[model samples]
Target: MRYASITERLASLGSEKWAVHVEARRRKGQGEPIIELTIGEPDLPPHQSLLEEATRAMHAGRYRYSNGRGEPPVVEALVRKYARRRPDVTSANVLCFPGTQTALFAVMLGLVEKGDAVLVGDPLYATYEGVIRATGAEQVTVPLRPEHGFHMQADDLERSITPQSRVLLLNTPHNPTGAVLTADEIAAIGEVCRRHDLWIVCDEVYEELVFSGSFASPFDDPELAERTIVCSSISKSHAAPGFRSGWAIGPAEFASRLLAVSETMLFGVQPFIADMTAYALDNPIDTSARMRQSYKSRADQVIAGLADAPGLTPVAPEAGMFIVVDVSATGMDGEAFAWALLDEEQVAVMPGSAFGSGGDDFIRISLTVPDEMIDEACRRVSALAMRSGVRKELRA
Candidate 1:
């Protein structure tokens, strides 16, 4: 029997990238003392006020279906939050979804399709390729070199554009690498997009997770507002990933046009969740601030622990909860080293190859674990790297 082309396009795009993570989970289920650090789940809980708000709304009968656009209160809250970033932002500019993932899917569908090209950075978030491929668009990967701090270079973006290019998918406080783009960097990339008439779809899910840099986005620039759409959620900012509350801020017309696509899949997010999301945006909380401190400290711990280890160099993240370590000098690629570390040291980490070729020599470590756990994990990783380095030297 034949299947839709989308099925073929997305065949290995999902859980396949998470092979190491899946293996680690299986081992842990069997009672292995695994220091799991593969995914980016927050170690913190949702703010108490946000939780209470959801419960209150649910008890008040907010379980019913919502409109295609979003719950009114949620839209209003989002407007006020974003209006500070771009003063002209209004309810019309917002479209709520279950999370940044869904918002991105809807936005991509509205912007590109078969025969078009979507320019995205290499070493992008694991799900980005699947999202773009699902739309039948060709994904043109622009190399994000580590030497440049993994931030997407405007020159590289411009070099990758072709006549078929329709959009530039960007992520700040970037996943895997945690590289945040500066205001000047954003303006440069925006200029490239403007020159080519490409839409900029930025995944700002980690917007509030910055540790060492100021955050900026194309959406914040008035000249780029019409072409920029920002997708974000309370997942990281409020420590509420399970709530599945997120939205897209874009040109009103784009949001209006995408409403049909969003409705076709999921008409709206849960009303109770919407209420909680609204509360999250309207009230400034310390959740993100706390996370910023914890994640940064944990990352520093790992980097410091590995400082004396042979052949392992942990890259400092400017933002976000994950840090990458270059393990190429140990005479093994990231996948091999990751499995070896799990088997020998009982530590689980995602191989850089899971992201893309750009990350082939690296392994990503999540900073969501406690300090003690991070310390132990760091020690284990350092030990493994030391052993691997010795083995390489002996072979030489």
Candidate 2:
């Protein structure tokens, strides 16, 4: 029997990149001691109020089928949320989906196809390539150099845009690197998109997790409004990943066009979940503050722990829940270091290569663990780095 070409495209893009994480999990599952800092699951639970709202909606029987676009209340809440940023935002400019991942997939499908190209930053989120590839479009990567704090430079972006380029996929408070783009930086990138006649599809899932600076996006600029589309969710913001509540904000016409694509995929999220999501957006809770503080503190702890460790250097993140540590000085790339650390010290972390070649020399450590766990993981990581350095000296 034959399958769709998508199977081939996605086969090589699957969990193989996560071999270290998977093995660490398997070991921990078997009762082996392992400090896992691989994935970005929030260490906390959803706010009590959000939980209560979901229960209330359930009791009120919100389980009926929803419209192709989204549940009314959720759409309205989204409109109000974006309206604060863009006074012109309305229901027609918003469409809700299960999560940022689904919204991104739909947006990509609607914008690009086999002959088109999607320009994204290298060292991107792990799933970004898979999503772009699933659309049958080519993924063109522009380097996000660490020398510039991993933010994508506009000149690099302009150079990568070819005649076939149709979209620029961006993530702010970016995953893996946790680099946030300033407003001026966004304007520069948005200008490049405008000149190249490209759609700007930004993933702002970490918008609420910025520690030091305010968040900015192309969606906030009127000049780029027509071409800018942002996908975000409450997963990180509200610590409610299981809810699968997210939305895409764009020009009204784009929303109008993407609604059919969304409908075909899932027909809209569960109404009960939509109700819970509406409550979340409208109530305006400050669920991210604690996360911001905790993640920042943990990141600082990791940096401090590795300060004296030879062959290890932790990059300070501007925002988000993970910190990137450059371990190339140890004479091993990220994948090798990650596997060795897990085997020798029982500490699990994601290799930089899992993200992209730009991160090959680094390891991404999630700060979503308890303080003590992260501290312990930091200790083990430092020890590994020291050992690798000593081994290098002996070889010399």
Candidate 3:
């Protein structure tokens, strides 16, 4: 029998790996040291206690299959952590998974049907679109305007919702733009969802990284909590990316449905990592304060540097480690500018176009690299401005 063609949704999904490969080849050929500022990966080490616990678990042969939901201790630890933040939510609402991405995928599989519509913010995390497409769902993008500080507008959100809209995917302390939604804005969106009978899938991976204001959840409202699915991981906040431990919190019915899908996806997460992750969660390191301050400094520097460079408008990020800079005045698209910077200056930044239409003239810069590297990248960007005769305007 002839093999069936790839599904349309799968065909539409583009691999970010291709961009990485291209950069690698270019760097090798040029004999240049690439200062990678593309991916949002923390360069910090994991908690020492977590490392010790993982070592013990490895020696004790604790690598066996666990309950598909998660090991009891890890699940309990996650429940306690979540309860501390969201007292209204119960342990029954939490389900552990290998990572937040896995939980998101499971949630989409369980909730969205073929040809269904899902609302997503423009300049959203690129991986989200792939996950939505994998479910054979249509993605309706809601533009987040830079003029409004890149925050989501409830009116715009409501206007985008349709009868086919089943879920709204949101990332606050959002990726690529680092815009955090205020509690009032979240409440407004909740009200819209309440009226429209929509489900919300919120990615709060960077919740602990907020600098200016208290972290707010869509689940902060009882009515919205009933319809919200929170997917969070220890990767960003705790600097434990390798642990691959995350949890999903939502209505028990939805959790059960997602659990069923999760079982078939990966059977269960590794018990050793889960146990170590629980240890880290219960005994959190005092890194949040340090990490937040460092990122705050970087964010300020990036904003100031971009201001000095002509034709670059940088959005000041209140939280998270990314800033989106508009480069439209340079007479080049985001993709072209990104490639030129990577090739000429050996700086690697993601093209804003990779995010979607609203990102055409923008480039996303991650502060995951060292402070010195960021300074150098800014200097190179300034040099480019000077070469292009844009510096004259800034000097004036």
On lDDT, the leading prediction is 1
What TM-score does each of the candidates earn?
Answer: 0.99, 0.99, 0.94
C-alpha local distance difference test of each model = 0.93, 0.92, 0.82
Regions more than 4 Å wrong, model 1: none
**All models, RMSD in angstroms:** 0.9, 0.9, 2.7
Worst 10 residues of 2 by lDDT: 279-288
* Candidate 3, 24-121: lDDT as tens digits: 55776788788777877787787788889988887888899887778888888888887786786666787888888888988888889776999999
lDDT of 3 at 129: 85
Error of 3 at 198 (Å): 0.4
The count of backbone overlaps in candidate 1 is: 0
Clashing pairs in 3: none
lDDT of 3 at 351: 87
Tens digits of per-residue lDDT for model 2, 59-137: 8998878887889999999988999999999888988899998999899999999999999999989999999999899
lDDT of 3 at 12: 48
Model 3, C-alpha of 160: deviation from truth (Å): 0.5
